[model samples]
Target: MLWGKNIYRLSCISSGMSLFSNLMYISFIYSISAKNSDSDAQGLVHPIRDPRLLSGVRPGITSSQGTSLQGSYYLRNSYLRHNLKENQTGVPLFLTISVTDTNSCSPIENALVELWGANNHGLYSGFSKSGSPSSDCSSWLRGAMETDSEGLAKFETLYPGQEENRSLHLYAIIRTDWYEHSKNQTVDSDSSHNAAAIVQIFFPDSLNHQVLNRTDYKITGRQFVKNKQDFIFSSGQGVLKAKAELPKSSICGGVQAHVQISVDAHASQNITVTESPYQCKTNCKAYQNTTEQTTTISATSKHKPHFIPLAVIFFASTYVFYG
Candidate 1:
């Protein structure tokens, strides 16, 4: 259910409203702004609720390194990065991308996008695993946005830090549609599910590179280049491209990188899927109609105000328990 050089951000929810089931209601939120030409959101599973499993293997890439990043100068974070627990409103570094369909290259407007990233300290906001308190907003670094006709999605946040040599990276999830030609095809097919791809955005000339020596890491910005020449973008080109432009300090305060993502037209608005439910399948490879039945009893000579009776019954039950 995954492939290619995509800024991947997948989430899988189970049935109902259980703690894990929240993913089911996520359908309304499946949209994203892609940075490359190949951004998409077509998964084999009709309702992909298990993100970790359906998200494919975490590519064989080295982790993020922080040495080269320490000595580097981040104008925006010059005063914001160190022990930021005291600060309330962190500078918002806007991360925006436009997503498109690969086959037709048209912008898939109104597509849902969700993103999650670490803070300047390489720690996720509002999480204990990244050294931030559970009540902190760091975990909230993740965000969601719908694409415009131009297939653009944007977010305002801060530059993530390089902690414990863990590389700074961003994860994204985009939702689109499948082309009719791809209907009935297996999820394993490369072109079968084309709406979504796992992509990695790296700091091309990051100061951390020099301080961390992450050149050996697989997911490092260095690995993004195939021949150590190209920006290491994946085959078929990405819909968006990102850059860091930290402005001058003083009247401008600290420097901040401007990440601009230009979407590719070829990869947008084309629904590519084999044997979709809307098409009415008879001999489709991936077909399943899950339904459940429940029975209910109604009171005869029904009275009005059902809530009053229910409240009385609840009060009686509570009284019995306490008495």
Candidate 2:
């Protein structure tokens, strides 16, 4: 009986040592995973400041410089009157725009927010310019909405793909007093009443990389410009950049981007609108004419399993049994 008890004690000691070793290994893995998660969160929250700005490089585009010719194509007829979220391809982007008064720092209600961007293939909906190669007048990733009493406007669109000499961006024209305009009305310098700030909203480079690497955007090739290398992005001074985050409970596995645009409601910036020579006029058609539908995608939760505590409890119970 004494010999049998000695062998049992030895076996329990050996088992406890093995359990302790596994606990240490698990702890090390959890620590490393936590560190990596923290690093990723930091990157999402705080993007790197443009290096060109630090070098005293003047921006090619200034706030007072107004809108670019490329942005001028956002006319009343360019987009459909239906929901922009309908029949869209690529990863979904839940974009929210908050319009505020620069002078009062208060929300600007009833403001018209028009948003336009390229599709997954880096093609604009209505234009046939060098970079935007659509001739069918198909309106895919473009729409307009009015701000609510809280000065918020939301749109569901696809993540824009890259174009030549430009980083991924969304063109917006916010107007304080929007009136019934002709179908030929284009956002221009003379249309000051309908144009408050014609700004381009940008995304973080890290976020851009993750989205663009997906299957839908990957076929566009790798010959696109980075935010730092792009002249317009360098000149914008990061004020127009959007804050991107993962949705807390998104049925769609895409990103949520938000940007608060502060504009002088009373003042009108002179935005030049030049006609594109390559503009497509014939065979113009809307992408989808069916009834609007909202599609939701389920995302897998990233929460880690609570196994450590259970492991500790089991180890304690084992030790007590042996004691």
Candidate 3:
């Protein structure tokens, strides 16, 4: 979702209050913005409810290289580059991506789901430095996971903070190798239960208000913008919407984001995976076997180190255990 050259501000829409399951309330989500897209709520598994699992996961990415990143590009092998701490800043966010066959609505197991989001202060891990975008790299909030037997992949992360004209959102890309096609390439006869789609999940105004106002998130002294002001939102139609079932007992509270992706069986060419936004190494194979039911992330190379300030580290530890 790049604008012009590098500006990738997606959109900021007031989250709709449409309720999903009884255990969950709508937070932020995509509205399947494609024309003639299916409106049916689709998923291949039961919603998540385990509190321990919900809180134990640590999600967030660090743009620590303190380098300026180009306007927009897809992050590669994101699952391994993040940390696994439970106490991250801002509101704790848990997300689940469900994959299913377009025809039967059956779950697509082992599908790789890659995710990346900016911290509460509007900086992305490994992509932004000292509050500005960078080409240098770091890792924490960026990562990936695979769908389980039930076609579900979940993560522990935080609510997205707004940047520039865009609203709070997370970037997602579902990758599968069954069929290959490009905008200029024709769809191969190859067919499989898998399909790939790029999506941006937005937040609810009610939730955005809560997260943005928190002392931890507000420390940046940033201004808030609405969906109407965001170009992607104002100009686009059929945005996808997501709902969450949050735990009420934790200090900052934990949430289970239940999101469903829709695929068109016949339109293999149209639904084929989009190219990764970031440039890949010559043979940039992912560090982990993306075909597993569940996967944890970590960096492969030990060199090319990045640094996080001690003050920020101290504040993070305090926020997680003492806040």
> Per-candidate TM vs. native?
0.37, 0.58, 0.52
Tens-place lDDT digits, model 1, residues 165-268: 33444544343431111232212223223324334455544533432342222233322222133332333233233565544542123223433332332333
Candidate 1, RMSD to the unseen true structure: 23.2
Regions of candidate 2 where Cα sits further than 4 Å from its true position: 1-64, 67-73, 78-82, 128-134, 181-194, 237-239, 248-252, 272-275, 282-323
lDDT of 2 by residue, 184-264 (tens): 222212222235567788998887777777677865446656788878788764238899997676424878889999877
Say what the RMSD of model 2 is.
22.0
Model 3 / residue 117 / CA error / Å:
0.4
- TM value for model 1: 0.37
lDDT of 1 at 309: 35
By TM-score, is 1 or 2 better? 2
Q: State how far residue 226 of model 1 sits from its true place (Å).
A: 15
- Candidate 3, residues 103-143, lDDT tens digits: the string is 77877665556677777777665545332333345545666
**Cα shift from native, residue 164, model 1 (Å):** 3.6
